[model samples]
Structure formats: C-alpha cells, structure tokens
Target: MNKDVLTFGVEEEFFVVDRDGHLSPAGDAVVDAADEEEGELQQELTRSQAESATGICTARDEAERQLTALRTDLAEAAARRGCRLLPSGSAPLAETVLPAITPNPRYERMSEHFGATARTSHTCGCHVHIAVPDRETGIRVIDHVRPFLPALLTVTANSAICDGYDTGYASWRYQQWNRWPSAGAPPLFGSLDHYESIVDAWLRAGAILDRAMVYWDVRLSEKQPTVEFRLGDVAATVGDAVLYGVLIRGLVGTILASEARPPKLSNEVLRAQIWRASREGLSGRCPHFRTGDLAPASEVLDDVVTFAAGALAETGDLDFVRDGCARLAAEGGGADRQRARFEKRRAAEDVVDLLAVRPARD
Candidate 1:
C-alpha cells in the first residue's frame, strides 16, 4: 500500500423507515431496487436495515460522489416502496415488534444461537476500510489506531435516543452493540500472530461463530485487504461519512509511515474511555487515552486532526478535514443535532424526521 495515498472504502448501514419514522421491513426491497452503478447496496443482519458499500476510492471527491449517489439512489428506491432512508444509528421510535432477521442462512443461524442478542441487534454503523499490503501491516495499523477510536466515535455519535426515550447517551447504539460477547475495542496486538491467536481462542471458546464475527471496533477485514475501522455510528449525512473516510485514511497513512509505538492503554481504561465518549459525544469532556486527562471533546478532535496533519497534507485533505471540523463545531455532531430536534417538540418522531435522508423530487 502507498503510505501517502492509500485507497479506502466506506460501508454505511441505514435504517429503513416509513413516512412516520417507524422501522419498516422494506430493506430488501430497497436494496433490490437501488441502482448499483454508483455503489453496492446489500441486506444487513436485520430486515429493517440496508447497507451500502462504496467501490475502492482513491480521492476525497470520488468517495463523496459515490456516497452521495448511493444515498440518493437508496432514498429514491425507498420512496418508491413507501419508505424513507434513516441514517441514524438507532431507531428513535420504540418498535411495536421486534426487528425481523434478514432471510440469510447466516442471519438465521445467528438468531438461533444468540436469541435476544440477534433479535435486538438493529443498530447501524459506518465502517471505513483502508487498504493495507498485508495482514501484518493491517494489524499494526489497528494497534496504532486503537487509542483514537473513542474520539472518532464521539464525533460520529448519532444514537442519542432509542425506544422512544432519551437513553442519556450520545450513542445508545454503542451500548446496545456491546452486548455481543465479541464486540467492542480490540486488544493491542504485539504482532500478526498475537491477533490470530486471540481469534483462535475466541473460536475455540465459542465466543464467536466465525472469523467474520470478530466484531472488534477495529480489525483486519476478512474479505478485503484493508484495515476496517468499525468504531463510528453511521454518519447522519454524506459529508459526515466522507469526512470520516478521509480521517481514517489519513490516520492509517500516518501509522504506516511512522515506526513509533502507540500508547498501551489498559483494557479497563480503554473501556472507560469508550463509554465516556458514547455518553458525552462532542458536547462534553473526553478522557485522553494517553494520559487519562479530561479535555473538551472538541479539543480532542482538534488533537486528532493535528496528529494526522502530515498524512492529511500529503493527501491534500487538510482543507477538507478543517472545513468539516469547523462545520461540526458550528452545527454540532449528529448526537447534538438529534437532541436539538427532539427538544423542539419532545417527540421521538421529530428526531427521526430530522435524520431522514430523502431524495430530491422533480
């Protein structure tokens, strides 16, 4: 992989909702109807969610175009099926019934094995895949990027409300997602062998059904030659999604170019930091993963931008990242926006309406 200009891709999961913002079982229909020329849409684990994967992207503008086009096409297809595309992490309104599992054999097996964990697993997330030449490099990148995962999650936190009530968390989806035994931040690995050993243990212990169930927030992709960062919620807009992809690419590039050892945060501290980030998002303080000092979330975000400065400059993404940070500062992150909308009417549906990504009409 080129350290300066590594190729990356983004996959975003979205909720399929009706006009009233209720979860709809039209995900398969939407995926089937969406135009695949821009990006690929696939069925998620649940019938209420659809996932879109962008083709390999080398430039910021290319990624933005593909993501925007995919969302637009998905929105149009959902409209034809009498549904809307909700880009939030979790369904704001309480489900009258449990979400239906997608009609795939793997999904069926998951439901059979995990029961409630599978039935209630309807959260959406944004995954960024940065190309790596080999698994060793990918493992190194994951290790180096571990400390910053909380900050990245904070910026993209969008699940403030769930089950028609305030969960008092910027990312309720994260809380729900961590119920899976295999989910959450991955352990720092000494080498590729160390990473595989942990996976081997999980398999032997029956903690995960397969390698694909290695649901760590960061991992080497089983199907792609990339380090996948699965830390953030599905962004609330195409711009937010693009910003996340570029930041991950820059961070991976920065890690690949440097030989410095990243901070070794303990598992307890790492879990605490992730919890704090999910609770506060960008509106409150974040614990510095290196020092455990509390700092404003915005300050931590600026620190991340500074940390990736060299790679961002080399890739000509400095301006875009700067502009995105400024926009988030002015308008707030996804969680903040969701809260603001909910406050207007004190209604969960209002939050859903605010997050619905609709297509332009003629």
Candidate 2:
C-alpha cells in the first residue's frame, strides 16, 4: 500500500476444528513462519483459531501470494499438532458444546468483561483493508460508504446453513453477531467530530471496557488508518475472499466519487434487514436502504454491481469485478452449494465434512 496507489490487503479468520467438528484451541504451540522461536501466530479473541496477518500487500498478486503462504504455514502447523483449520462463519452444531479460552491475560480480561456472550461458538470473517491517507479520509470513506454495507454483506453471503438446521438465514454469522451489545450498523456521522464526540462520550461515560467495543459492523480500524468492514462472515473459500475484496474496492471508490450520501437507516430497520438477510441469505427479502425497495438478496446484489460500474472501472477493477460476479452467478452462491450438498446426502454432517482448509497448489 502506498500514498500514490489505491491499494488493499486482506485479513481472514478461520475456525480451527478437530475432525469431529469440536473446537480446537490454537494454543501457544501452533507455529507460524513469522513467529519468534518462543511465540506463535497470534490467537484471536477466541482461541478456536490462530490468525496469520499478511505483510502490507499492494497489488493483487502479492496479496494472493502472501495470503496463500501464510495459510499454508498455518495449515501445516495445525496438522502437525493434530487439528484442522477450516474457513467458516460459525461452529457447526456438532462442535458447539466445547468452550474454553486459551491461557492468556487479554483473553482472561475478555472473559471477565463479556461474560456469558464471549463463550459463543466460532464464526470466521474476512476483513479487507485499503490503506487510507489519513484518519480523516478513513472516517470519510466509511461514512460515505455506509449505504453499501448491506450489499457487501449480500455478495459475500456464505452461511445459509448452520449446525444440523437450515437457520433459514443467508449468513448466520450476522444473526450470531447481532447479539453483542456494540454490534450492528454504524451511526451516520455529519462530521468526523460527531463520530469522535460519540467515542469520547462512550469513554467518558465508561460504557466500553475499552475502545474495542466500537463493534459497529463497519468502523475505522483502531490501530491503522483504514476503513474496515466487519460485515462479511469470513468467506468459506478463497475465491469468495477475492470476490469480497473486489467489491470493497468498487464500492469504496464509487461512494468517494458520487453524490450519494450514506443511507440513514434507523437502528430498528437496520437490525430487521440484518436478521432477514441472515435468515434468508440471497433468497430472502431485504430492504434497499437507498430506494426503500424490498427485494430478494440476489436482486439487490445485482443492483449494487450494476450501479457501481463506472466507479469499478475507475478503480481499475471493472473487468475483475464483472468476471468475479459472473463466476458467482454460474456457481450459485456458497450458501446454495452448501445447502444443496446437505440435501443430496440428507445430513449436516455431509456439509461439515466438506468444510476444510485449501492449500496453495503446486
């Protein structure tokens, strides 16, 4: 990422599960290429997975190379230690009962702080970050891009089935996430001061245990100058990750260059849409916040791509976005495939059995 080039890097989370779908702790021993001799790949807030962060990557090839390398290292480490790394949103029903945090001070603090809610099962998500020029632009980009959040959520939809049941949601992770107090959509900020005013107010009010509670579906990354969208359930496949990354580039640039203001979706309305999408996936009906049109998830997503073509081209990803989306159209969404796989075998075990970590091919 550089000041001169508009660029992005990707971060992803996976559920480390045993063959039986039981949650497997990454522990302190899971090795990573970047780790010191004594340390390891960083454990997530939940110890069910270990995260390997890629070095800042500018072009698509470099991002793909580094991500593949990191995932390969992690897969080898997890296998050597007797567990499997699976990219997914929530813990499958078969593994939902296991609960224990790995040994760490920060995890202990989180357990003490979040209490009952912190024990929830795994759900992976991809976080795509473009390097921002400054905090002001970061906030500005997020604010300007809020209208497109639901569409981003739709295109990346992959969790229509959960446990042994059809949760009847497109992305069940959204349903699971909405339970957290600080989660859901962000507030529409008239200015950066208004956004800071709220954060400062929360600190002054002692509302959050720390700044991490700003769990709005999308936010400015606290440690870096970038707008981060937490809306996607980590894609179940690498292709889905690339698709999401492509959409983020198009949507961010589209908003930056357009006259459109972020849609002012009320908390109630926003939650309703999130719940609807989670339950129905692309087949479910959801509101178009910009036009108030209620349509199926598939229809709304098409509109998102069709509307952003100019911006997509301007960002130099027009063909990439078109080809990627066409691929989705031909394949059916991830949810559709998972659900179909279950129907074919008449079992959730079959679907979970298909969940796995993909290696970079030789």
Candidate 3:
C-alpha cells in the first residue's frame, strides 16, 4: 500500500445553543454566517445542529490545524447570531420543541421514515475518513478494524448529561444512536462484492431506504474513496480530534501491512462489546477482541496504542499520540470533564459552558 493511503479527514457536529445555554434551532443562521466567510459547514438532520469537515490532510498537525480553525470559525459565527456553540455529544438542557429537519429531500425522506428518531435526535459525533488504495483495501480495512472500534469509543466518550440530568453512562449519545435500525457493528464480509450485496439486500428488504442509512460503526464511504469511521463522539478539543485521526490512520496502516483477515465474532458479542464500551467508557473493563478476555480499559487502550506504534512512528505521530493519550488518561476525557463540572456547580448549564470552550490543558 502507498504511504499516502494514510491521508485522512475529520467531520465534527456541534450543538447550537441560545444565550441561556439551552439548545436552540439556529443552525440556518450559523450556517449562513459560516457560508459568508467561506467556511466548510453544513446543516445536519436537526435545525439545532451543524457540522464541519476538514480538507484531506496527511499529517496529524495539519489535521489539528484544520479542526481548530473550523471550531473557532463556527463558534464565532454562532456567537454573532446571539447563539452559542457547544461541541457536546448531546444537548445539555431539555428542549420543549422538536428541532426542525434540514430542508433537503433526502433528510425529509429520512424524517418520514424514522419519525421521532429524526426530530428528537440532537446528538453530535466526530467521523474520521481515511484514504485507501481501492475498494478492496477499504473493505479489508473496515473488516480488520471492527474489533478495536469499541475501545476507540471508550476514549472519545463525551456525553454524560442530557436534559439537565446526568445520564449515568459516559456516552449517552452512543446509546441514543444505537436505536437506529442498522446502527451497530457490521458483520464481516469476504469481499467488496459481498459487502455491496449485503447492502443491496438491506435496501431491497426495506431495512434501509438508501445507501446513506447503512450506519455501521465503520463503512465504505459512498460519496468518497475512503473508509469512514462513525464511532466516536465529537471530541471536546482540536487536540483530541487530531489524536483520534492519527490513531485511526495508524490502525488502518497496521492492518493493511499485516495482510490479515477479520476474525468472525458473533453479532451478539460485537453488540455486547459496543454497549459495554459506551456504558463504562474507560472506567471499567473492556473485552479483548482476540482473546475474549476482559482487561481494564486503560490497559486495553495501551495495548492498542502499542500495537500501532510502528505505524504511528512512521507517520511522525508517535510522540503526539503517546502524550495525548497520557494527558487524556490523567486529566480525564470529555465525559469526565462534563461530570466534574456538573458535580462542582450542581448545574448542567455550567457543563455546557465548559463544553463551549477549548478545555484548559493540564
């Protein structure tokens, strides 16, 4: 595989809030402001949310720079409209009205099909897109990387609160998202043809209306020539997002280099692993994909990092990833930070405030 295959991009969704720190349906205003400034922003399923995507980047530092610029520009644009931007996984405060759907035909069809799930779903997430040599490599990447995705979610956990109360789970957004018809881990496919056949079967069976509804944690991008990872929450800072991008590219590179095939785990076990990761985050044990043995989440994460060390080093991202992981473990992840703020102030709004800013580094 060409080393350039490691090129990647990130997309992050954000919540739009009013001055009172409550979810607000101001996505249009913010998007218009962003458009005037030539920012790469778009409306989401709900009018209360917006998303931004970074251009293709080859280095971790370049990815971080693009993400930081997007976050800063979007926040400033939202502020100009008297609405605040919160890069939180879920809305912090309760909302009385359903957010309006984005004015597009496909989103309209999605709303009609999913009903309340579309209107009430205000969760945000960060998706990583990594380049591959071809369709075969993309299929191979998604298959081989499936087992490790749960542990990746443990690191990006961020939604600890919802509707002014603690949800008790580290990433409530994952739980909410799992409610979709085809939203969990995908089954292993032997070839790119097999993958497309399964997708075709789903569409014909009405399990999904279109290709876009195939919401597996990882999938071949229908719109691009890359494998898309849709597992993690929107990171709380640019650094965290960059860390995720680096680690994903490293994992992909490692898998491609080894020329390994995916192991067959029952769908039941895969779903169980995903749920456990979301529920406990990094505070509990994670089930090892190969051994089926449980270990502390931190230890499991360390093993993952160690497994990809060579790839990370080759990309010149080893030191940054090592330091970033250490910092996350020490200072706590987004969910920990949100819970700490709520615990200290006894107010969910303060958590929203903290989510709005780039968290102070330890």
Clash totals for all candidate models: 0, 11, 0
Model 3: residue 65 alpha-carbon error in angstroms: 0.8
Best by lDDT: 1
Question: Candidate 1: worst 10 consecutive residues by lDDT?
Answer: 1-10
The residue-level lDDT of candidate 3 at 252 comes to: 91
Can you write out model 1's per-residue Cα lDDT over 1-362, one digit (the tens) per residue? 23547999999999999999999999988999988687788999988999999999989898999998888889999999999999989899998899889999999998998999989978999999999999998888888888888888887899998888888999888998999988998888879999999999999998888999999999989999999888799999889889989988888888898989967877778888999999999888888756778898888888889989889988889889988987887789999999998888889999988888878661
Model 3 over residues 258-309: C-alpha lDDT tens digits? 9665888777888888888888777777777567678877778888889899
Best by TM-score: 1
- TM for every model, in the order presented, reads 0.97, 0.88, 0.95
Better of 2 and 3 by TM-score: 3
Candidate 3's TM-score:
0.95
Score candidate 1 by TM-score against the native. 0.97
Question: Which model, 1 or 2, shows the larger lDDT?
Answer: 1
Per-model RMSD to reference? 1.5, 3.2, 2.6
lDDT of 2: 0.68
Identify the runs in model 1 with alpha carbons over 4 angstroms from their true place.
1-4
Model 1 residue 175 lDDT score: 90
Question: Can you tell me which runs of candidate 3 are displaced by over 4 Å?
Answer: 1-5, 35-39, 358-362
